[model samples]
Target: MSCAEESGRIMVGQEAPDFEADAFVKGGFKKIKLSDYRGKWVVLCFYPGDFTFV
Candidate 1:
Protein backbone atom coordinates (compact mmCIF):
# COMPACT_ATOMS: atom_id res chain seq x y z
CA MET A 1 0.00 0.00 0.00
CA SER A 2 1.11 3.54 -0.70
CA CYS A 3 1.57 6.25 1.93
CA ALA A 4 -1.76 7.92 1.19
CA GLU A 5 -3.61 4.65 1.52
CA GLU A 6 -1.99 4.21 4.89
CA SER A 7 -2.14 7.91 5.78
CA GLY A 8 -4.27 7.11 8.77
CA ARG A 9 -1.14 5.79 10.42
CA ILE A 10 0.04 7.67 13.52
CA MET A 11 3.55 8.30 14.65
CA VAL A 12 5.51 9.33 17.73
CA GLY A 13 4.19 11.43 20.64
CA GLN A 14 0.64 10.35 19.94
CA GLU A 15 -0.98 7.79 22.17
CA ALA A 16 -0.62 4.33 20.74
CA PRO A 17 -3.65 2.24 20.07
CA ASP A 18 -4.43 -0.90 22.03
CA PHE A 19 -3.29 -4.10 20.40
CA GLU A 20 -2.78 -7.69 21.45
CA ALA A 21 -1.32 -10.79 19.91
CA ASP A 22 -0.52 -14.33 20.96
CA ALA A 23 3.05 -15.38 20.44
CA PHE A 24 5.36 -18.21 21.45
CA VAL A 25 8.39 -17.29 23.51
CA LYS A 26 11.06 -19.66 24.78
CA GLY A 27 8.80 -22.56 23.73
CA GLY A 28 6.05 -21.35 26.02
CA PHE A 29 2.79 -19.43 25.73
CA LYS A 30 3.04 -15.65 25.56
CA LYS A 31 0.47 -12.92 25.36
CA ILE A 32 1.47 -9.46 24.16
CA LYS A 33 -0.81 -6.75 25.35
CA LEU A 34 -0.19 -3.29 23.97
CA SER A 35 -2.01 -1.71 26.88
CA ASP A 36 0.61 -3.13 29.15
CA TYR A 37 3.15 -0.76 27.58
CA ARG A 38 0.95 2.29 27.69
CA GLY A 39 3.32 4.68 29.41
CA LYS A 40 6.38 3.39 27.59
CA TRP A 41 7.66 4.09 24.11
CA VAL A 42 7.69 1.02 21.91
CA VAL A 43 9.42 0.28 18.65
CA LEU A 44 6.59 -1.45 16.82
CA CYS A 45 8.00 -3.23 13.81
CA PHE A 46 7.76 -6.03 11.26
CA TYR A 47 9.22 -7.24 7.97
CA PRO A 48 6.98 -7.54 4.91
CA GLY A 49 8.23 -11.08 4.60
CA ASP A 50 11.08 -12.64 6.54
CA PHE A 51 12.90 -14.63 3.83
CA THR A 52 12.40 -12.21 0.93
CA PHE A 53 15.06 -9.61 0.19
CA VAL A 54 13.68 -6.11 0.03
Candidate 2:
Protein backbone atom coordinates (compact mmCIF):
# COMPACT_ATOMS: atom_id res chain seq x y z
CA MET A 1 0.00 0.00 0.00
CA SER A 2 1.02 3.61 -0.57
CA CYS A 3 1.42 6.37 1.97
CA ALA A 4 -2.01 7.75 1.21
CA GLU A 5 -5.03 5.62 0.69
CA GLU A 6 -7.88 6.15 -1.81
CA SER A 7 -9.78 8.37 0.62
CA GLY A 8 -6.60 10.51 1.05
CA ARG A 9 -7.26 10.90 4.76
CA ILE A 10 -4.63 10.09 7.36
CA MET A 11 -6.00 9.44 10.79
CA VAL A 12 -4.72 11.38 13.78
CA GLY A 13 -2.00 9.84 16.01
CA GLN A 14 -0.86 7.71 13.10
CA GLU A 15 2.75 7.49 12.03
CA ALA A 16 3.63 9.65 9.06
CA PRO A 17 4.59 7.49 6.14
CA ASP A 18 7.80 7.87 4.20
CA PHE A 19 8.10 10.60 1.61
CA GLU A 20 10.73 12.35 -0.47
CA ALA A 21 11.34 16.02 -1.18
CA ASP A 22 13.98 18.53 -2.19
CA ALA A 23 15.91 20.08 0.74
CA PHE A 24 18.59 22.68 1.15
CA VAL A 25 21.74 21.30 2.69
CA LYS A 26 25.40 22.27 2.89
CA GLY A 27 25.13 25.27 0.57
CA GLY A 28 23.18 23.25 -1.93
CA PHE A 29 19.89 21.48 -2.53
CA LYS A 30 19.41 17.73 -2.72
CA LYS A 31 16.72 15.12 -2.70
CA ILE A 32 15.89 13.81 0.77
CA LYS A 33 13.60 11.18 2.12
CA LEU A 34 11.91 11.17 5.50
CA SER A 35 12.86 7.58 6.13
CA ASP A 36 16.53 8.45 5.82
CA TYR A 37 16.44 10.10 9.24
CA ARG A 38 14.78 7.19 10.93
CA GLY A 39 15.77 6.66 14.60
CA LYS A 40 17.21 10.19 14.62
CA TRP A 41 16.10 13.68 15.46
CA VAL A 42 14.55 15.77 12.71
CA VAL A 43 12.99 19.20 12.70
CA LEU A 44 10.21 20.21 10.34
CA CYS A 45 9.41 23.89 10.25
CA PHE A 46 6.81 25.83 8.24
CA TYR A 47 7.00 29.58 7.65
CA PRO A 48 3.69 31.36 7.40
CA GLY A 49 5.16 34.86 7.00
CA ASP A 50 5.85 36.32 3.61
CA PHE A 51 9.39 36.90 2.35
CA THR A 52 9.77 40.62 1.82
CA PHE A 53 12.61 43.06 1.66
CA VAL A 54 12.37 46.13 3.82
Candidate 3:
Protein backbone atom coordinates (compact mmCIF):
# COMPACT_ATOMS: atom_id res chain seq x y z
CA MET A 1 0.00 0.00 0.00
CA SER A 2 1.16 3.56 -0.66
CA CYS A 3 2.27 5.79 2.20
CA ALA A 4 -0.95 7.78 2.23
CA GLU A 5 -3.17 4.70 2.31
CA GLU A 6 -1.01 3.07 4.97
CA SER A 7 -0.88 6.24 7.07
CA GLY A 8 -4.69 6.21 7.25
CA ARG A 9 -6.68 3.20 8.41
CA ILE A 10 -8.60 1.54 5.57
CA MET A 11 -11.81 3.48 5.04
CA VAL A 12 -15.33 1.97 4.93
CA GLY A 13 -15.93 3.12 1.36
CA GLN A 14 -13.15 0.88 0.07
CA GLU A 15 -14.12 -2.57 -1.23
CA ALA A 16 -13.77 -5.31 1.36
CA PRO A 17 -11.41 -8.24 0.88
CA ASP A 18 -12.78 -11.02 -1.29
CA PHE A 19 -13.86 -13.87 0.96
CA GLU A 20 -16.28 -16.75 1.55
CA ALA A 21 -17.15 -17.57 5.14
CA ASP A 22 -19.75 -19.38 7.25
CA ALA A 23 -22.64 -17.75 9.06
CA PHE A 24 -25.65 -18.53 11.22
CA VAL A 25 -29.08 -17.89 9.78
CA LYS A 26 -32.48 -18.51 11.41
CA GLY A 27 -30.71 -20.56 14.06
CA GLY A 28 -29.26 -22.76 11.31
CA PHE A 29 -25.77 -23.15 9.86
CA LYS A 30 -25.07 -21.74 6.41
CA LYS A 31 -22.36 -20.36 4.14
CA ILE A 32 -22.46 -16.62 3.46
CA LYS A 33 -20.27 -15.80 0.50
CA LEU A 34 -19.28 -12.15 0.23
CA SER A 35 -19.22 -12.31 -3.57
CA ASP A 36 -23.00 -12.78 -3.50
CA TYR A 37 -23.31 -9.13 -2.59
CA ARG A 38 -20.72 -7.70 -4.95
CA GLY A 39 -21.25 -4.00 -5.74
CA LYS A 40 -23.73 -3.75 -2.86
CA TRP A 41 -23.59 -2.75 0.77
CA VAL A 42 -24.05 -5.50 3.36
CA VAL A 43 -24.66 -5.06 7.05
CA LEU A 44 -23.65 -8.07 9.12
CA CYS A 45 -24.95 -8.56 12.61
CA PHE A 46 -24.95 -11.06 15.48
CA TYR A 47 -26.43 -11.69 18.91
CA PRO A 48 -24.67 -12.83 22.07
CA GLY A 49 -25.00 -16.35 23.48
CA ASP A 50 -28.13 -17.18 25.39
CA PHE A 51 -28.28 -15.89 29.03
CA THR A 52 -25.81 -13.12 28.21
CA PHE A 53 -26.75 -9.54 29.01
CA VAL A 54 -28.59 -7.79 26.21
Q: What are the models' TM-scores?
A: 0.56, 0.55, 0.48
How big is the positional error of residue 1 in model 1, measured in Å on the Cα after superposition? 23
User: How does model 2 fare in lDDT?
Assistant: 0.67
Q: Which candidate, 2 or 3, has the higher lDDT? A: 2
Name the weakest run of 10 consecutive residues (lDDT summed) in model 2: 1-10
User: After superposition on all CA atoms, how large is the RMSD of candidate 1?
Assistant: 6.5
In model 3, where do residues sit more than 4 Å from their true spots? 1-9, 45-54
Q: lDDT per prediction?
A: 0.67, 0.67, 0.62
Model 3 clash pairs are none
CA lDDT, candidate 2, residue 51:
84
Deviating ranges (above 4 Å) for candidate 1:
1-8, 39-41, 52-54
Which digits, one per residue and each the tens of the lDDT, describe model 1 over residues 1-54?
111122346777765666678767898988787778867867877769768885
List, residue by residue over 1-54, the lDDT tens digit for candidate 3.
112122335468775555566666899988777667977878865577878875
Between candidates 1 and 2, name the one with more favorable TM-score. 1
How many clashes in each candidate? 0, 0, 0
